[model samples]
Target: MAPILKISGLSKVYDSGFTALKSVDLEIDKGEIFALLGPNGAGKTTLISIICGLVSPSGGTVVADGHDVIRDYRAARAMIGLVPQELTTDSFETVWATVSFSRGLFGKPKNPAHIEKVLKALSLYDKRDSKVMTLSGGMKRRVLIAKALAHEPEILFLDEPTAGVDVELRRDMWNVVRELRDGGVTIILTTHYIEEAEEMADRVGIINKGELMLVEDKAELMRKLGRKQLRLTLHEPLGALPEALADHGLELGKDGTEIVYTYDSQGERTGITTLLSDLSQNGIRFKDLDTSQSTLEEIFVNLVRNQQ
Candidate 1:
């Protein structure tokens, strides 16, 4: 099947000679959760804005569900639903009224039942009649999600959807997102929280300084880039590593009472057996040992740093 969203050589520049995006290319599959990871000012939002028709690109093109985003604006936009990072809904209107209005704005015929379903899915049904101003910040965020879903869009873009929300609400929103994906909605999420991406994304894309560094399947990325470490709590403090242990490439901890051995998981030989045998020969003994593997956050940070 063709990609649901396609961006080719996309670039964006500001009036001040600031390039917000480089020649970037990306494709989002249908019903998959793609997490866009980046530091602030990395063009995540700029890329999204261009696809949604909120911002013009300096070069290249975007297609959403086979519709040219620029030439066929209405058709492309109708397939997308965006939940912005900030809350910008009308404060005077009731929750139900605002959500209903949003769907109407998209030229979608009035469907009270669909509106009710959206509200209820987001746990906003009970607050349907409440004014936006009276709702809490978290509730307001939920309202934003409800509005986005009111039109039954096929593709959803969530920009930091869980930001500022409590743990419970965040989990609740994650469930909603999964349900949407299960129901055949393609989701693209940008988040500062690496844990969120690790927990929810089928694929991860990393952007830094307006350039897309890499995009890969979440599991494949971890398997290819992840490293493991073995920490040995030394039986005795070592002033310095002995010359015999130089081949191990071990790092001494601050306290000198611990040593760490880092190795690649993809390597054929971990060298753990040799290192242990050498330690025994050198009269070095470990009181205890612990092993750990690199997390998605660690891999992400390393990739961005290496790109810079």
Candidate 2:
């Protein structure tokens, strides 16, 4: 299937000669949730702004659905909904009015049914009559999402949508996002919360220093990059690792109560049997052993660190 959004050789340069994006090429499937992860100044927001038509790219092409972002700006922009990081809403307007106004901005006709559904999906239906300024920060965040969905966009860009919300509210927003994706809205979100991406995205893209580092299916990315650690609790304390175990690159754990071995689970051989045999040959006995795999957050940090 053709992508709902396609970006090719996308480059962005500012007036001060700073390049915010560099030759980025990406494709978003029709209805998948894609999480774009990056550190501060990594060009995440810049890329989103360009796609949403808030900022112009110095070079490259961005196509939303079947419309070119530059040549067919209105058509491309119409297919996308953006919830920016900053809270810029008509504070004095009621929730319903604000969201309704946003829909009209895209030249969409007044559809009270659609607006009500969006508000209710975000748990904002009850507050639809309340002034935006009177709502709490969390509620206001919901209003932003409601506003984004007002036009019933095919693609949504959420730039740090849950930045300052409480944990409970964040989780609530996650559900709303899932519902949107489930409803066939292709989602591309940039988030500081790695777990949020981990929990929600089908694919993950890591961006660093304005470069597109890696993009892969969530589970595949974890399996290919994630390392596993085997920790063996010792039956007796050993002040140091045995000379024969040096080849295993073993690390003595706290007070020599355990031995830690890091290995790639995806490799053909993890050498667990050999390591165990060597340990036994050296008078090492393990009482218990457990394993753990690297998390998405860990993989993200390592990738960013390597780029620097």
Candidate 3:
């Protein structure tokens, strides 16, 4: 199937002579949740803004649901909904009015039924009559989501959707995002919360310094790059690693009371068996051992650090 959103050689340069995006090419499949992970000043928001037509690209093309974002601006933008990181709603407007107004901005007809469903889905139905200022921070965020969905967009861009929300509200937002994706709305979200992307995204894209570093299936990314560490507690403290075990990539820690071995998780041979046999041959004794695998957060940090 063709991607719902296609970006080819997209580049964005600001008036201040700063390049916010650099030759980014990506394709988001229909109905899939794609998480874009990046550090500050990493062009994530710039890319999203260009796609949503809030910002124009310096070069290349962005196609949204078969419409060119630049040449067919209205048609391309009509299929996209964006919830910005900043809170920019009118404080005096009632929840229902604000969301309804959003739909009209896209030239969509007044559809009370659709608005009500969006409100209820985000748990904002009860607050529909309440003024925007009267609601809490989390509720206001939900209001933003409701407004985004009011137009019934085929693609949604959630930029820090749960920024100021509580833990419970963050989980609630995750459920709402999943529901949107399940209902055939393609989602692309940029979040500082690495765990959110880990929990929700089917595919993960890591961006750094205006360049897309890697984009891959979530599980496959983890498996291919993830590393495992095995730490063995020594029965007798060793001052240093034996010459025979030097090839095992071992580290002596805890004042020489622990032996640490790092290995590729995806490797056909982890070298654990050989290392263990070598340890026995060298008369090295261990009291206990523990194993750990690298997480998505670690992978994200390492990627960003490498780019730096």
Candidate 2, residue 57: Cα displacement in angstroms equals 1.2
Give the whole-model CA lDDT for all candidates, comma-separated.
0.93, 0.93, 0.93
lDDT (tens digit, per residue) of candidate 2 on 99-213: 9999999999999999999998999999999999999998998899899999999999999999999999999899989999999999999999999999999999999989999
Candidate 2 matches the true fold with a TM-score of 0.96
Arranged by TM-score with the best first, the candidates are 2, 3, 1
Model 1 score (lDDT): 0.93
Tens-digit lDDT track of model 3 for 94-210: 999999999999999999999999999999999999999999999999988888898999999999999989999899899999999999999999999999999999999999989
Q: Which candidate is the best by TM-score?
A: 2
**Residue 287 Cα positional deviation in candidate 1, in Å, after optimal superposition:** 4.5
The TM-score of candidate 3 is 0.94
Off by over 4 Å in 1: 234-240, 254-256
Candidate 1 lowest-lDDT run of ten: 264-273
Q: For model 3, what is the C-alpha lDDT against the true structure?
A: 0.93
My TM-score estimates for the predictions, one after another, are: 0.92, 0.96, 0.94
Off by over 4 Å in 3: 268-270
